[model samples]
Target: MLLLNSGCGTKNKNSFESDIIIYGGTSAAITAAVQAKKMGKSVLVVSPDFHLGGLSSGGLGFTDTGDKSVIGGLAREFYHRIYLHYQKEDSWKWQKKEEYGNIGQGTPAIDGDERTMWIFEPHAAEQVFEDFIREYDIQVYRGEWLDRENGVSKSNGTIISIKTLSGKAFKGKMFIDATYEGDLMAAAGVSYHVGRESNDTYGEKWNGVQFGVFQHGHYFRDSISPFVIPGDPTSGLLPEISEEPIAPNGTADSKLQAYNFRMCLSKHPDNRLPFPKPENYDPSRYELLARVYASGWDETFDKFDPIPNLKTDTNNHGPFSTDYIGKNYAYPEASYEERKAIIKDHEDYQMGLMYFLANDPKVPEKVRQRISEYGLAKDEFIDNGHWPHQIYVRESRRMIGDYVMTEHDVLGDKTVPNPIGMGSYHLDSHNVQRLIGPNGYVQNEGDIGVKPKEPYSISYGTILPKKQECENLLVPVCVSSSHTAFGSIRMEPVFMILGQSSATAAVLAIDAKIAVQDLDYEKLKHRLKEDAQVMLLSERLK
Candidate 1:
């Protein structure tokens, strides 16, 4: 049954209508809904997951905020509410407030004067999102999966209504696809790209297959063999290593960056749950990682980033870590059942890896002892067996709209027109594939991290579809951008910024009786500024 709130009671049971319909349960969806209601417009959030705040509350507590100055609008307000929650004495259940230091991404987590906290626990972030929904009286339908095949009803180039898998239909004047997978936008027959574009296609240097260019430390520094038996090709390639032909440098490919759960782990004795071994645990599957360990590459605990309450936002760091590479190639366009299988495969792989590391005798004693001290936080994700509900979908189907944001736009080499928001994070793409290198060694490819010279503006046209494709839709999470450009814009704070900006545009377009593509940029800019959206760092810093 659909979990419809009081806002839907005024409408028919099977069909509900609103001024704006946001299809997702992400952090962006929450922000977009709040912004729409703030403008006195009716909004509905059709969420696929039971929980809100996608990755923001799904174990990604240690945020990837490059320049905190560029974060504003409802994004900053969300952090401010997180700060307020931690101020209460009862909020510190596992650790004292003073014991949890104020260190964030090279800055203070608790900024007293600014009244914001960048780092937080998963439940804390979810609580803030729930508060936003309750305070704004936003109507939400949880566990409503979008019927991608025959769900969207369109007239000419505009979406009329959308149906869910449960036979419930929703009608709205404007729609926002705030999903991480862009399911609503894809179902509406919008033009989108599935994989990395070549440098020749975008006329940018960092937009394609980065084979030999290892920018981050997530590559094979030492020679690690990729065979079942070292130096024996006849023994066949290892289990997880891909046998596909490697593409040339700067060329296009369909492979996507790896996906993993940003695990929230705890060292607290009373609240720690041991790493559960999967039903199909295979110790031999992590042979490549064991060999990497044999080659003396031991940086496994480098990315155990700390959040509040003695919990760590554990992320993929070294060569063979949490990221399950080369296993999600068909995920962006896969069916719901297929995607569930993929997610299950990832969970099994990660859990098997953890079990192998902590219990397997082949692992070094020192490494096993170090990892044995930590376990999944039993108090978090109480409903989902202490596992995160959302996977870190680094990149997926990006809409190719009227204006495609390339690496040049991200690097500030090309100017962006009609700015909606700003992003300062580095172009960070995780490893896409672990294949046999040219020199016959196991090597990872497609890990690139390049910082921008300054903060870059995200264009307003990014969220809009092509004029002929869809006129009333806005895509914030999977905006129009090249594979490399999406890396910088895919952060949680930036998603919230674009979500609020998208809603403001949706409401203005509705009031002015125009398409989202035809909305006046000046009017949108005025409202965004009035709502405290930071369009330019120079303007905000001044």
Candidate 2:
């Protein structure tokens, strides 16, 4: 805990350090910083995004929390802040609270907890995140991306410092990798894996192999031409569908997850702006979608969950919707400009899709009008043309830590030694690849949805690397897990929950002058419980 200046022109050395340095501006990142601060440690949050919350404030107002009882500590405190904002009565501009009661995709609203509403408005969530930063007095450096290749420096398996893209060096006693990509952990020389592991590798029934499952209505029963030229092999597959055959059962391969816009639409005519035709709008790009419409598929508005006022968080649906099925392969490792181009491509594809449904002669009139009634909310995401700033990063580089949680662990057949948090969402991965079936029909692969019998404990070892790998880095957002296990643990609430626990462990490690992997679990658990973290089900009963 000393400030040093290694002066120029000499082998000069001085020390400058913080108790904890958190990367990423997601809700989880903020939660972790707040927890560290509450532990009387100085903390700083460096984020790639200018905005505070990741997806929670970035258009996904309707949360995807499975079991609300499991969300506690700083995560629960975040929602409570949202509830407090709404109590002002001025927060409800578009609709009343009574009209919007306990309605979401999978979870029920908790009547006793005012803060536990499963659904909310985008601005409300953002404000809540901002309030946390203000109240905790956490310092945040926005628009700063980490230089992953050489950003992290370590000695004796402990992180010495991390430098940003702008060469702004941050020296912290402990660091938390709260990014979805696990960039910090990877850069720090910790082992991690991208894409799925073959199911056989982990003996996981749901890990790498996914066959003959259609939970999201993304399969076609009949032959649909995937190209401009109908039924001609020479014409080749369309831009969206890949030429490669879907890998066989239990095979390990990298495939793109579906990408979609979390559209913030409104029925309020004053606030609604019709989906615009993107700059590079190509009608041919939507041939598969047109074919889907031709097949009597009419579930376009199925996921327009209501928020405050008449606003809705619109999502993808049917065989062809917001999810750009096979185009995100280059995204996880792409450059910033490349990521922008990919994002723009998705925007065009999705916007053109909306325009096609609303104005194209081929679309059924009823479906067109239903989609036409909705438009982007002018008030939300004003900085980004009312679109979601962050793409829904479903899966990324998962750290392979001391303990890797697998399907067996989530199924309650196995238990983790050091429990940090709990997650109950069904193991869910969106379709990974589009393929031609033996029946001469196009189909989607890698869509697995298996429900866990009960909520399972997330291992503390999953968040910390082995002592010899990297001692000071804690990965909360991208924890150690197989692809199948990550499916259940990837929820936003769970990330925030893990963030708090990770930060607690970071502070404790610094105080004990020990590596994060060597922190005493008894002390960690005691601090977590005192701070209202949900580490055990029996603790909740008490």
Candidate 3:
């Protein structure tokens, strides 16, 4: 088990420690706290975000729920709460449920026992997450960033307390690392791996074998010259296209998945604030996007699904879209100031892209006019001037825990014994890097999209570090998995389910006075079932 460094003093402040200490205000963190509270445990949720829900309330109103049945416990309860909110007739401000399209982008919206509208507005989601906190009367410390360098304290291979950046310290018998990047796991000195692992390492077909293959047909001809000299080595590659050969198949590398902001836009004239030219906006940075438009790519307007008030939750789609690929490699481990700079760079790039699409003379008139009709929603994210409060952190440092969930486990060949939750989304990895293909074509690599036959089990051991590595910490967001395997497990709903399970495991460990790695699977499973967690795939499919 990984042992954390003991602090200089032995005194534990705040004599009464909570049963569980969650170090984030994300959807996962809140869900974990709520679950722990339901089990009659004193729970405290400390978060860096002033808001409660992370991305769930942060402009991702159109949920990425694959198989909704697998979502149980606090996750299902969250949706149920949403349903109750809409039960009030006044909740439908702009359009009635019957008028709004229930289906979009291949996912169907069905009315269930709860009146919850699966897809909703950003404000509505935040209200539901807030209501959960109020219902449980859970203690919450907002704007508390973890002191990563030297804040965590431990005793005999178990964490005793963790101090936030503001110097406020919280001590607990059990700790749950629910942050997307696993900051607490790292600060607690747990073992973790970053970037992609080769197919050979896992003996899986999809892991690293399909690096440069673009199944979505998003690639373009390299012969079509962007520069004065096309393919000559002396001429140098274009702005976004890297000259490196797609890393050879079945080889481990440090490349990470792409990230982007989910823009909340609106067409309502009064509510919409027209896309503005960002500070330091450069026309030349969008040369690649200009070229894409020149190549007859007009699918940019396809992903704007309408929410309430004529607003849309715009997502990334097609080539040269919102995903600023290859620009976020240093983000997962960067300093706070550096992270701010990176977030600003992404904000500037995305905002400039919108402005360019709406105003640039080079863009096709129809595309320009279509994009110009929409703008930022004025009411949402009021603190950040209606911009998305959270950036979409697609993938980050994954713990190399006791049992690594490889592609085979997700594909159903290997049996995952202690299934804590289930994931049914396709193994979808966004483009890693832009490269020049052998046929003198400009191509994008690392965008692997493969369908799963059925929902697969997410192993319990994946949530905890190896028995010899870390003892008290439970990681739900960045669970142990191969790079490709993570693609399926990385969903909002699945994270919530795993969060509930992680908190349950933490509480069980606290009561047993044993390391998290030593918790009996049978007992844990029993507790999970008692708490309404769907631990098996068959239970969900049925």
Candidate 4:
């Protein structure tokens, strides 16, 4: 039913007809456009969002990069620019250089000799991406949502043109789906998997519904009654507690992991925005957290990771934290308005959580006082009411291409040919649903983490569609992978690396006058190496 890449030139000479049309204003989108420009290909980015750099420019400043060496090329260059930005004295306006000490995920935030910085502010990241655009003269159509219902017009398995909701049309020779949701790829009729598959699907150890498998302290520490009143099942289950039976362990299901906003909080009095009691904010929604406090699991401030200017990259930690479990299951396939509603629900819930912790009399005095000290960063994301503009979309629709990167590849058990990039992070998935444990207590499920022995190669095939499906399109952010491997490859830096690599391959494909799948790997690999992409492990890493 599908046709391979059609080797036809553009039907018309127009400004909308670019060499490459990349969708999504993600970090990958910017990098891909830059790479295409560097290769002398005219490119344009059609972003549904008004802002660029999805999570990188959002509030997820505490980067979750596993190995620094594996990240090179434009991805490394971006961070190097961040390092250069902070070198100036004026860069530290709110906090002194020595006042905010550099911290990271087991490494220094500022790497001087390497000329790369890992941790940064949300605005700083956006500035770097904006710089990439200005320097490259990259054309960007921001805030143009794709007309998913009928905008895409494909011919013989090749996308001819994409129309946006604004009645704008863009045609290109090659396409790249850089969005977190893989919206373009999905519209182009690419096969993508949504949620966790059974372990048997890819012979993976960490892929399915994991009920008792605990990684972080996200599970209920002590057995709390799932019922409304203390020990009476007749009183009925509490709100947000699922009454559905937990799926059998290692069984396949369509449920997805939780998503949350990586909040930017500040303790500075001048730079703190109080968490307003959001509209329709109900205090009873966070009664579980009150119970969590009563159980003596009070490590709420543990994940307030320090970035720059006395700000913290706050994340989900402990039981009943920022992750709104089971609320985002319909988001991947939801309509724009429906997705907006889901986002509002999550915002209300998280803001209500903050309010409950700070003002609720049911919370312990020590806990209340500690949480009350921090609020939304005043100078950050000012347009979006001081809250983060982007939610941490941990995992989304992953393409099932010619090759699917599985847990075996993630664990380095299988060899991956034609390496375009490398992913070294742990196989991390947040809690999918909050359900009543077998013991009739509230507990979260689907949070599983398995760290890799070392960084592994992400194959070029992972970004390529099946030859019969589409040959001109490349997916870098939501690449072809099983849920097991996507858990690691779904990281931001890897997305950047793959973005550059995918664009590079597209350039090579255009230059060679062939389909992307039929292009010479030897040539593609050489080009990537020339661009300073780390392709192999060093002797020390081995």
TM-score (all chains, Cα) for each model? 0.98, 0.94, 0.94, 0.96
Candidate 2 residue 250 Cα shift, in angstroms, is: 1.5
Query: How good is model 4 by TM-score?
Result: 0.96
lDDT agreement of model 1 with the native = 0.91
Runs of candidate 4 with Cα error greater than 4 angstroms are 1-15, 539-542
In terms of TM-score, the best-performing candidate is: 1
lDDT of 1 by residue, 1-542 (tens): 11112233335678988889999999999999999999998999999989999999999998898888888899999999999999999999999999997889857899898989999999999999999999999989999999999999998788888999999999888899999899999999999998889999988898778898889889989988899989999999988899887888888888899999999999899989999999999988999888988888889899989898999999998888999999999999999999999999999999899999999887888999999989999999999999999999989999999789988998989889999999999998999989888999989999999999989999999999998999999999999999999999999999999999999999898888788998889999999999989887665632
Q: lDDT for model 4, please.
A: 0.87
Candidate 1 local lDDT, residue 8: 30
Off by over 4 Å in 3: 1-16, 104-106, 221-236
Ranking by lDDT: 1, 4, 3, 2
Clashes per model (N, Cα, C within 3 A): 0, 7, 8, 0
| Residue pairs in clash, model 1 | none
Model 2 lDDT tens row, 353-427: 888877887888887778777888888888888887878888778899978999898878886788988888888
- Give one digit per residue, the lDDT tens place, for model 4 in 134-228: 99999888898889999888887778789888888888888899998888888889899888899898887788889999997888989988888
lDDT over C-alpha atoms for residue 231 of model 4? 83
Is 1 or 3 the stronger prediction by TM-score? 1
Give me the candidate number with maximum lDDT: 1
- lDDT for model 3, on a 0 to 1 scale? 0.80
Q: Estimate candidate 4's RMSD in Å.
A: 2.6
Candidate 3 per-residue lDDT over residues 1-542, each given as its tens digit: 33232222234553225667899888999899888888777888889888878888888877877777777778888877776776677877655766767763345543554444567778888998888899899888888899899889876677878998787788777789888888899888888888887777878776663555776655553245544255565776666566666667667778787888888998867778888888888877777778777877778877787766677888878777888878888988998889899999899989988998899998899988888788898888888988998999899889999889987888887788899888878888887777666666666777887877877889998898876666888999999988888998988888899999998898787677789888999999998888778878667732
